[model samples]
Target: MAGVRDPGALTSGQRTVMAATITASALLFSSLTSISVALPVIQRDLGISSSALHWVIVAALLPLCALAVVSGRLGDVLGRRRVFLAGILCFGAGSVVCAIAPDEVLLVAGRGIQGVGVALAVPLALANLTSALPGHRRGWAIGVLSAVTTGVSVVVPPSVAILVHFASWRWLFVAFVPVTVYVFLAGSRHIAESPRAPGASMDVRGCLFIAGGLTLLVFAFERSSDWGFTNRQTLAPLAAGLLLLVAFARAERRATDPLLDLRPLVRSGVSVPLTALAFAQCAVIVVTVYVTLYLQQVLDLGTIETGLLMLPTSVGSVLLGPVVGRLTDRGAGHHLVLGGMTLLTVALLWLAVGVDHRHGALLVPALFLLGLAVPLVYPSAGALSLGALPASARGVAASLQIEARQIGATMGLALMSALFTAVEWDERNARLADPAEHFTADEENKLDTVLTEAEKGQALLARLPPAERRKVHDAADAAFSTALNTTLIAAAGLLFLGVLLALGVFHVPRRGRRRPGP
Candidate 1:
């Protein structure tokens, strides 16, 4: 394996590669937040339904989830630099399409195209960065990159808020094009092509199976809340996706040149990090979505304020990133990762049981801890997962981790939504059944019809008398808060499980050893 000539500093070329890849990541991640911030404007400008507006986000995620493994494997079979550049072209073209789009349909189509580019670029970018240096130093690079991107994710919202306030939402799509072009140009000149498998044939059937499976699964979960779990639309796709994934596994086992070689996943070091990362992704989507919902729906905070309030988590990530990286390089990654998971669990429990309007501002500390937890877990888990594999397998290894996180994110959304609805419904029903509540038949009927969690609060309150509204609103808020807290508790449990899994499965090097650690 090739090593960086200087252990202390990156060469000019390595720095260029790092900058281009990290910049590309910033571009991709920032788009999600920018679009989120601009969604209201987009809906008003396009005059689209609430349902249709969601497709703008879903379209991007689907292709990104589906194509990741294939893109990573293609990098190994073809060339990483070549594929990475092509991704830039696709992303830029898609941005142009979105910038010029006149309607929701075209915008969603453009987003899907951009998702394809993301699938190609993101995993390969990591593969390139880690491959640029020797194994021992990869942790620091991953840590810095994670911190930078996390910061970007937080920072983009405030800037996007300003941008959307002053300019048309279309500018959001156009704003990044120049940066994209620069990264493309810089990468073409500076990024070296990774080692490719000579004359290796693409596993066409395996690619089709996994892509089709993941796309279907993601679509099913993304739509499950809206369509209802028992609805035929949801069930049909969910069952089909599972079947296809099973077929994909079978196909991979038989293929001579598989798109995703599954053998590495059986190793304890690799599997533990991958699983832990998946759990972390689940925690992220769950906490972020529910917290945003809490801020907006319960407290009625505006988008900008809610975003700003979420900054402590981002701050913690930035503060701890470099330290986590240094610790990993020193063979302390095992302790850091498990400790991070434990912290995450504690933070989630803190929010779950204690969060309230009176003490809501105190959430800052817990959120800050949440921030600390991610930098500790993510970069370290990524380093461990990739480091466990051979150089030849690193591309696929990175892709596998990406795929797991994507699936985890989708599943997290589904799980939280499902659990919230169930808990909220039971809470509402138990109230309706109580004589102490003294609910009229009309109110009972109205409450009984409330299916979605959002409807339980404002929708019901809007129909009640001013005198009656406050009581119903309070009850609704309590239910919503209860549901939210329950979901957080569930997330906390998962993080605890992640900690246990890492401890049980992963065997770390002893302290005072000079050996490299995964």
Candidate 2:
């Protein structure tokens, strides 16, 4: 504990550790969305085909989500500090690779390397921060970390747009190299080493199973929207993923030092929180995806306006974070989580009812409620899940948290995609059935694909008479609105399920009593 300092006054060493870890967290999470904003620029610069553009996203996300658990266990077996430094190195190297990449292949490979680094760093950062603080202060610190990372996302889309507009897209990757180096140096100096499990060996078989399982699952979900869920490509991977995951569960039970200790899921009562996290994340992702699409396609908002409209959620979360953290520290984690879940459900319901081809700003109140709701549940649920485990297991516990949220996001994307696609297809068929429309098969097919794209849809209808075109445009808008409302209702239902799960797992401590730490 060379750099260790007492928690009182939060010494410079402690401050450095917090600053470094929090900065790393912000950078990593920013990558999740920023690359997407830069995708168009990347495609034009690298001559990347439209089909291959998605791989840019999948390349980074697949490894990040797949290897997260293994990375956490690695930190435990080796030293967290060692793994943390390694992560910084990998991410910095990958960013350098991306900046210089001349083709799509190298760019994608660089992204994959970055994913590996994220998988390594994110959980360890959390573990390190949790270890740095005394039990009483961990919740508040976590809240601040969560707040900054989530709040920064509000600015990321617009920032990336500005950066891409003013300079080369490659600069996006290059600009962060200095920050990465700083974090690495500062972390090496200030972040204390945590307990390395003596005699613990790497769970090689478990790692392979989980990495393969999760990668396949995430791949299947990401592709499901395009491949169709029932298509052989999707079903085959889905089955394989499920089988591999089952095998992983069996292997962990037998391993001397499992990569993931399932007992904690039940013993620490973390299963409930994990379940809540998953369902809550599902709802959150659905809102994010559909709401953005709704704003653009239905309400006819520009990219800048859409990004600006999304700010309420970020602002609400930032403002409410400290209060929620204080309440959680006061043994109100359970109540906060339940209340948050309830509010989330209500917000979703409001969005569902209010969705229309009207002013986009009307959604602001619900979005802000969503922002407030998220901070309450996310940090509290995280504390409830990780705080219940011993320090030695916190890394693995953090990995579990990350994995749950990622899986939830993947599932949400797939679910909403399927629902929305089905509605689109149904709407297309209904239009085709109308004899008065007199649509040809080719025209119907073109309309089917572009129903969600206002520009494309208008172009496709350009050959038609103005009256017919207007009718079709209005119909497409209505269909898109219906799809959005359906997804919102579905998200609301998922949040209700999360509320019930939270109720089962958490209980407020009596007045003047604090919940016991692990």
> Against the true structure, candidate 1 has what lDDT?
0.73
Report how far off residue 191 is in candidate 1 (Å). 7.2
Q: Candidate 1 — which pairs collide?
A: none
lDDT of 2 by residue, 1-518 (tens): 67776546687888889999998988886785456545545655665533244567667766665678777678878999889889888888989999999998999899888888888887788889888877877888887897788667777867765676678789889987998999999998999897888876788888788778876776676566557788999899989988999998888888777777776776535777777787777777667656765665567665556666766666656687778778888867778778888998999888877795355556888888888888888878887787677777776777688878877765565656666655655564576454325556545544632434434344567767666766676666776677677778877887787777666545433333343455
Candidate 2: misplaced stretches above 4 Å? 1-21, 34-59, 76-82, 92-112, 126-158, 161-174, 181-198, 222-228, 386-396, 432-476, 504-518
TM-score of each: 0.76, 0.77
Model 1 segments beyond 4 Å from truth?
1-22, 33-58, 76-82, 96-108, 124-151, 165-170, 184-197, 226-232, 354-359, 386-396, 421-479, 506-518
Candidate 1 local lDDT, 77-104, one digit each (tens):
8899889888888888889999999887
CA lDDT, every model vs. true structure: 0.73, 0.73
Compute the lDDT for candidate 2. Answer: 0.73
